[model samples]
Target chain A: MKTKNMISIWFFVGCLLALYGALILAAGLQTYSNRRSANIAMQNLHLQGWWGTGLLVIGLFYVIRFRPRRLR
Target chain B: MTSIFSAMLARTWAPTSLIAAASRVMSLGGIDLTIITLYFFLVLGLGLYLKKFTSTGEDFFMAGREMTAWIAGLSFISANLGSLEMMGYAAATYQYGILVGHAYWIGAIPAILFLALVMLPFYYICQTHSVPGYLQLRYGEATRSLSAISFAIMTILMSGINMYAMAVIMKVILGWNIHFSIWVSSLTVAFYVMAGGLLSAIFNEVLQFMLIWLGALVIPVAGLIETGGWAGMVRRISENFPGQDFTHMWRTLGSFTGNPMGVHWTGIVFGWGLAISFGYWTTDFLVVQRVMAAKDLRSAEMGTIIGGLFKMLVPLIVILPGLLALAVLPFKLVPETMANVPGVHTYNEALPLMLARYCGPGLLGLGVTALIAGFMSGMAGNVSAFATVWTYDIYKPLIRKQASDQHYLSMGRWCSLLGVVVSIGTAYLVMNFSSIIVYAQVVFVFFIVPMFGTVVLGMMWKRTTPAAGFWGLLAGILASFVLWLCVKLDPSALRLVAFSSHAKDMAENVYRAWWSLLANVVVTIVVTLFTKPKPEEELKGLVYGLTTLPSLGQLPIFKRPIFWAGAVAIAFVLLNVLFW
Candidate 1:
């Protein structure tokens, strides 16, 4: 595949992951507010919000900064 | 932890931890849900995106022969690393102890290396799209058709096992609706496989491999740290499960009477390592299709070697979790938790229980998603293999000998969905069998054992006739089922049987495969003596001695396939000795 198409695919992957991450983080907010709904292990771990943020960062980096150098 | 999921022909079943776990996760909104949903979206995106790049039969079925060694090698093993494997190996190790590592080490390493060094040249040179396609050239249309039909059925049945395991386990643990889980898995697999075909399937498998490794890594790391390391973990297992051989891989293999696996060295070495392993690694179309998609012959061969190296480490990920669970996880659930879950008596819940103890929420989501990915990878692998065999080997030859490449390409897509639809029936069908993984292996034995004998004779001997191949394969299949049924009729009949039998599931599997292979070889030879063989000129490019293979002699030491093979073999010996 050409570099341009490769970049576009990765770009799209990045966007999708980042979008889902945000939604996950938002759900965690509501979950945290309702103490009855939240499980202690999950609440103690704080899984949703942080992993979502991590996904956004990873995806954004691939979308904006990553590039491969051509071989000699 | 789920049920033992084993179908012993003894009909012993165990309950899983699915119901209790699922209720708890549902209360927490099932963190697995969020991660899994995103994962599904990403997979569909990839399949749809790759669809544009896949237009012809070659591209859809074989990735247009453009994959690198890295891609091919990872995809090769990934296709085999489904949830059934991850959970099954762990559960087996929990029950059988460290002897289960043989499945990865001696069982896999040699066969993979042999495929790289010996078999790739013929397959690549002949350029058959399917393993059955090779049979057509070496044997005849009857042999190929039998193979194609049996293999097509095998793939769908195997996928059905995966689907059933995922749905059943999810329902019992996470309290998800079973039909919903099945539909989600089936539709997602069908969508991608129908859209991108094999390339999409291969690409997702590689992705799943990465996720599986990342997801599973935490369990061992956390368990070891908590237990204070490998030595500590071993010490605990010995203390908890007293008088059990929990750590040694080969130390107790002097006889079938004592080892945890209950198999003597003959069964371990000849039956498992030689017969079953070689049959699976060398000839099965599900995995071989991935290798055939490589960019070139060198890459294809190199890819298998690389895969072998990775395979040597797989036991550490899958089996070690079971050992860890044995050392630390609770054998019985607390009463409060038991209220939501059914009771069982076994170590089959080792992996998931350990996962729950080790991973919190985020990591839990990732870990569970890894398992889900494994389920889909297995389903996708079977679906894609079924499509290739159906479209290329069965449909094209028998139904329409003269169709456009486009027509076949369309047929391949439709067949991918058709295969998944058939798998739904099979998924329900396999539920009647007790254990998902064991039943799957039993299915493989009927096809692979006898099929291996036919392929080996056809490829190595010029005198092997097509009639010999057909009759040999048929006889072998018949013998396997008959032997199994005899054992089924009387479970105690195993001791009266030959080839080493301690009556355990794993050992029983080894002996059956050995018997099948022996029958296949003897029947083929006996039949060949009475029949006329194929002509010498017709055997060119198919038989070993007749075909002039591209020599690897000129390649540097580091680049040669033999060098890698030697390196892997030495490592194999070291592992056996170290574990011993």
Candidate 2:
């Protein structure tokens, strides 16, 4: 019974991360280029996008796999 | 003329650097603001939603022990990966070079494994809610009370330091009133923690962990790309520092004489690795509480192991940028930001400036949010731990021992709110002492060094008496204070402790930990021999010999905790070799 509460919490956190990830991912993809800035930092929007995807995938995995298995 | 890096990197932003960073974050557009605002409100909403579940003290403090390994592990490390750790350590790397990696590598990995393999079994089997509870069982009430008081004071001070540091950083970045930033951050953390207790804090820490990695990981990627990848950065670093040992981790570690860290492998291996790391990772309540909250022994142990694994990779984000800043940030940042101190430069601005320099509009907002998340997560970790220790160890035992669980739950919420208020007061105190804060900060290392000695002896040996534990702990703390005082009086006094001539604050800290631990162990041993030990029945499941140790005989070899520990330790040794 207590497991159900934690599963819900995990699901909630997973969904939030995925949604946030998707937002940043869209912008990152939109800014896709070799160097996103000329400020000597040379930040690649592409790599930034990859992290977004990583968070998204991990979040999705948690929500999917940790979904509570109802008692038989 | 001093280097250009000194000119460009102001020693610290009085009001201007804050404006600059605020402008950088502000320029990221309204979409960024909206996202940050929504994120804040969502966290608040989660806290409110979880309030329904925290009906008992157990639910409030431990989340009813329902946390999976992943949740516990991420929360475990996230609590320690506060934004200051990012900014502070980045600045440390900027100033000290690659040697700081020892703090994460040898300093954390082994101790974490030790906790998982040896300590977690005892903690879980005995059902101790907090580190102090372990003391009560293993030693007695006197030792437990003493530790609980010291740990209580220590945790709150740390939480305040987090609040003060973040407030100062944000104030420097956004030009916000320091008091205003303190109140706002403290209230936000206090609110969420009060509403949902540890469950809310853990959930947010997991969220914050993901956000921090997402935002922070960009600095290295961007820096590497611009610097022409790994070889380019290294080549440029060599060119920048010329003959100075900027990237060597172990080559110069053979001697404490002329090294940049001013200490040899003895300091790293004994001071940091065994004493400091073991004391902190094995016994410190802040991280240990997270481990204890896991659903079961396996989850708790695995959570610590997972944290160790993640700990191994932390340097790339935290340290690499400081190394990159050496070559890429140009020489002008130094002279531009040079403070009143002659020949000194402000490197504390490394992480924030890195964020400002690289991350574009959308990504910049994410970065700002990540910084905010880092500070908030740190604040929450402290407050919840404070609340738990206060309610369980201090208030419940001393003030009202027989209170109903429901009564204790309310007190837990009340304590969370009160802890933030205390942190705010302490934060103000810190602001006043910003210049010589290093002296005050010695409290953190001192508390742990002595506590570690007593805890290590108590857990492993059955002969350690209650009187011995109490006296040893008290003596260790006082001894640490005296050592630090001598070092502070005459920086030259460090030589008496065998510290190198070129020793800096970090070196002093390393040696101080070592001497204190040895002193603590000596005191404990002598006292234990003179006093009567607890009988066998009381020591059951508390000491190694008396306890029926958990075995993984039925599990497959790969599924065993030892398998993971071996994997992490092997990787640890290989990394040392690779860097060596």
How does model 1 fare in lDDT? Answer: 0.76
lDDT of each model, Cα atoms only? Answer: 0.76, 0.77
The parts of candidate 2 lying over 4 Å away from their true place are A5-10, A25-72, B1-28, B332-337, B340-345
- Number of the top-ranking candidate, with TM-score as the measure: 2
User: What TM-score quantifies how close candidate 1 is to the native fold?
Assistant: 0.88
TM agreement with the true structure for every prediction: 0.88, 0.91
Worst 10 residues of 1 chain B by lDDT: B1-10
lDDT of 2 by residue, B1-580 (tens): 0001111111222322232332222244564666577678878888887788777888899888888888899988888787777776777787778888888898889999999999889888988888888898888788889888887786777677567767767766555577887887788888999998998898888888877887788889888888888789989988878887768788888887656668778888898888788888888777888878898888898899999998899898888988888878765234213434443335677777777777755567778788888889888988888888888888888889998888999999999999889888877786776542444456666777788889879889999999999999988888878988887787788887745667766776777778888888999999999999988899998888889987656888877778998999999999888887
| Global local distance difference test of model 2 | 0.77
Best by DockQ: 2
Candidate 1: stretches off by over 4 Å: A1-72, B1-32, B332-346, B429-441, B498-501, B552-554
